[model samples]
Target: MPLKMDAAALNAFLDQAFEQVADDFVVEDVATDRLTVRLEVSDKHLRPGGTVSGPTMFALADVGAYLMTLARIGPQALAVTTNCAIDFMHKPAARTDLLGEVRLLKLGKQLSVCDVLIYSKGQEPPVARASLTYAIPPQ
Candidate 1:
C-alpha cells in the first residue's frame, strides 16, 4: 500500500496530539503498508534495574500500531487502542534506541489489528513483539 502520510506528516500529526509525548519516541519511517517507530532511550523509560519498564515498552507498541492504523485508514483521531498483547523477550540496552515495525494484520470497518515487532536499534532480532487492536470510529 502507498502511504497517505509520510514520516514527516505522521510525526507532525502525533506531535500535535501528544505534546507530552516522550522525546525518546519517534515515527522514524512510514509507508502505507509499514512503519518504523523509535523510542529514544531516556531515564524516564527505565525501571529500577535499569531496564525499560513494561509500561514504557507498551507505549512504543501502542503508538506504533496506532499510527500505522491512522496512516492506512486516514487521520482518525478518534481511533483508540482496544487491546494489546506484548511479550518482552529480552532486556533492551539502555544506551541504544528502540525501534518498532508494525504492519496491519486486519483492517475492518470498525476495527484494525496490527502486528508489531520491537527491536533494539541496530539489533538483528526483536526485543519484544506485540499484537495491537484498535477501534475505529464510524464515518
Candidate 2:
C-alpha cells in the first residue's frame, strides 16, 4: 500500500485513540520505515525487580504495530491485534522512557505484520522485541 498518513497525522490519530486511552504513552516520532514511540515508565509499569513489566512492553509493541499499520492504511481505527509474540531480552531501567522502534513488515487487505524493538532511553541494548499481527477491518 502507498503511504496515506504522515507522522503528524499518525500522531494526531494516536492522541485521539490510544493516547486518550492512557496517558502513559506518547507517539514521539515516525518515519516511512520506522516509528519512535515512548512509554513513560512508572512504578505501575515495573515488576518485582524494578524492571519494566512484560505487559507494559507488550502494550507498547501492540500500539507500535497499530501505528505502523495506520501510517500505511490511514486512520483505520478498527484495525486490531490478532496475534503477538514478545521476547524480553533484557531488563529496562526503572522510571525511564521505553522507546519502541516499529517496522511494518507487511500490509495487506486484511492483515498487517510488524516488528517492534523496545529500549529504555539512554540504554544501549534493547529490552524487548515483538512480532505482531493485526487484522484490518473492512470499511
- Identify the leading candidate in terms of TM-score: 1
lDDT of 1: 0.85
lDDT string for model 2 (1-139, tens) is: 5678776787778677766545776777776667888888878888898888899999999988988888888898899999999999988888788999999887789999999999999997999999999999996
Cα lDDT, model 2, residue 136: 95
| lDDT per residue (tens digit) for residues 18-113 in model 1 | 778835578878876788999888887888878778888899999999899888777778899999999999888776778899988888899989
In model 1, residue pairs whose N, Cα or C atoms come closer than 3 Å (at least 3 residues apart or on different chains), thus clashing, are: 24-40
TM-score of each: 0.93, 0.90
The CA lDDT of each predicted structure is 0.85, 0.85
Residue 72's lDDT in candidate 2: 81
Model 1 alpha-carbon drift over 4 Å, by segment: none
Report the error of model 1 at residue 106, Å.
1.4
